[model samples]
Target: MSVIVLDKLTKDFKNGRGVFDVSISVKRGECYGFLGPNGAGKSTTMRHLMGFYQPQSGSATIDGLNCWRDQKQLQSKIGYLPGEIAFPVDMTGKNYIRMIAKMRGMKDLSYEKELEDFFEINPASELRRMSKGMKQKVGIILAFMHKPELLLLDEPSSGLDPLMQSKFIELMERFKKAGTTILLSSHMFEEVERTCDRIGIIKNGRMIQEINATELRHSRLKTFELECEEEADLNKLLVQFPKMLYDRQTRIVRISVPDSRINELIAALSVCRLRYLKEEKHTLEEYFMQFYGGKSNV
Candidate 1:
């Protein structure tokens, strides 16, 4: 069953840009990755799902409860980590977590020890003195301490060190094993590729594609470099595969073809005295680029 569902969800701001007719579903016990570049409506979509902002049209729901209408009840079943960590700097890390626990009506402090041991968070450190990474660890602890059924994480690892990031992934795996649903929103392609079961790519407030990670890897475009015995017939080849990009003067050719055509290309190349034939499979970055015109540094 779907843990979360967005049906034609549309949210418009005064400036007139937000998620446009966005529709998607996340299944139970699956890590759903929502990916896009900056200003690509990622955060807006998340806000709609979390009931922070009501959509102008359409609807969003969690566990069949209307997100905007049943927000209070939904909050009890889900934990959220926003992209930015805003806290009372005067409070110590331990105090902040305890306050959150109290707000959620959870009395047990047992989870605190486990979280501190795993994240290495210093309970006594003041929020003002903690590094950005350390503050992020506190946010993670608060989100997971209650053991909610669903986790809504928006760039949950934005500030952590490499070691801590690795630990965060391990923690996510543990959550999945325990039948928790996770919705991870981020621009980091590598992190999404590692942790997500299925990913949805959005561009200009519209969802361009949604595919399983394994299927995307299998169907990724492969780039091949072919050097023919003599000057190759670039014109003929270009017509056959219009997507091919070539440089004839250097006798170097680059082309990205679907997996289905790989065997055919190899068979045709076998006839020529091939100097080098390399396959370049698309990474999550490249797959993201396909929808966003091209990759952006941001």
Candidate 2:
């Protein structure tokens, strides 16, 4: 069953800055990574799912409930961390947590305490005085403490240090193991790669690509770096593989081939006087860079 569904859900703003015709379906107990650059509609799509904005077209649903129409009931069952954190400055983190727990009718805070300790958060400080990272830790605890079956996190680790980021990934893995359905929206490739089963990349308010994590990990596509003994050797290899990137000055070539074409690569290289051939490691970040014209800023 699909725990979360967005069917052509769209919300257009006057400035042309909202999501357009976006569709996604997240199955029960599955984590779906909504990957995109900052301002690429990831947060907009998430806002629709959270029922914060009414879709201009189509619909958003969670467990068969209309997101906008059934927001009251849905809010109680979902754990959400917004991209932008906003808290009352005067309220202490401890008091804020207590207030939210009280509103949710939660009597026990044992799990909340556990999360605080795990994140090394000192919630006694006022929200106004806490650093961005500290406030982020508190937000994370609040989102997970209830143990809701559905989680929607938008850039959950934005303010986190590298260590805290890893800790967040571990927490996500634990949640998935406990059968929680999650929609994680972020620009970080590593975080998405580590926690999501499937990933969708959006650009300019539109989804451009969707990748299966398992397929991506086990893909037969491989890139190799080859050095030629002579400049002429590099020219011959380029004739065989026209798409190969050649550095004439260094006589080095870079080419990507599928497993089925390994023989073809070997044959092409065998004819060329080669110094050495090396297999280059590929990362999800590198793959994603293709969509942005080799730009890693995304």
Question: TM-scores for all candidates?
Answer: 0.77, 0.80
Q: Model 1: number of clashes?
A: 0
Candidate 2, residue 143: the lDDT equals 93
Candidate 2, residues 82-181, lDDT tens digits: the string is 9998999899999999999999999999999999999998899999999999999999998999999999999999989999999999999999999999
Tens-digit lDDT track of model 1 for 1-298: 9999999999776465788899999999999999876777888888887898888899999999999889998998898998887899799998888888888999887987798899887778899999899889999998898998999999998898888988988888888899999999886777788778999888778888888987877777778877654565555556666777777776667777778998877765665565676766456886577666655322
TM-score: model 1 vs. ground truth: 0.77
Regions more than 4 Å wrong, model 1: 220-282, 294-298
What is the clash count for each candidate, in the order shown?
Answer: 0, 0
Which residue pairs in model 2 clash with each other? none
CA RMSD (A), model 1: 5.6
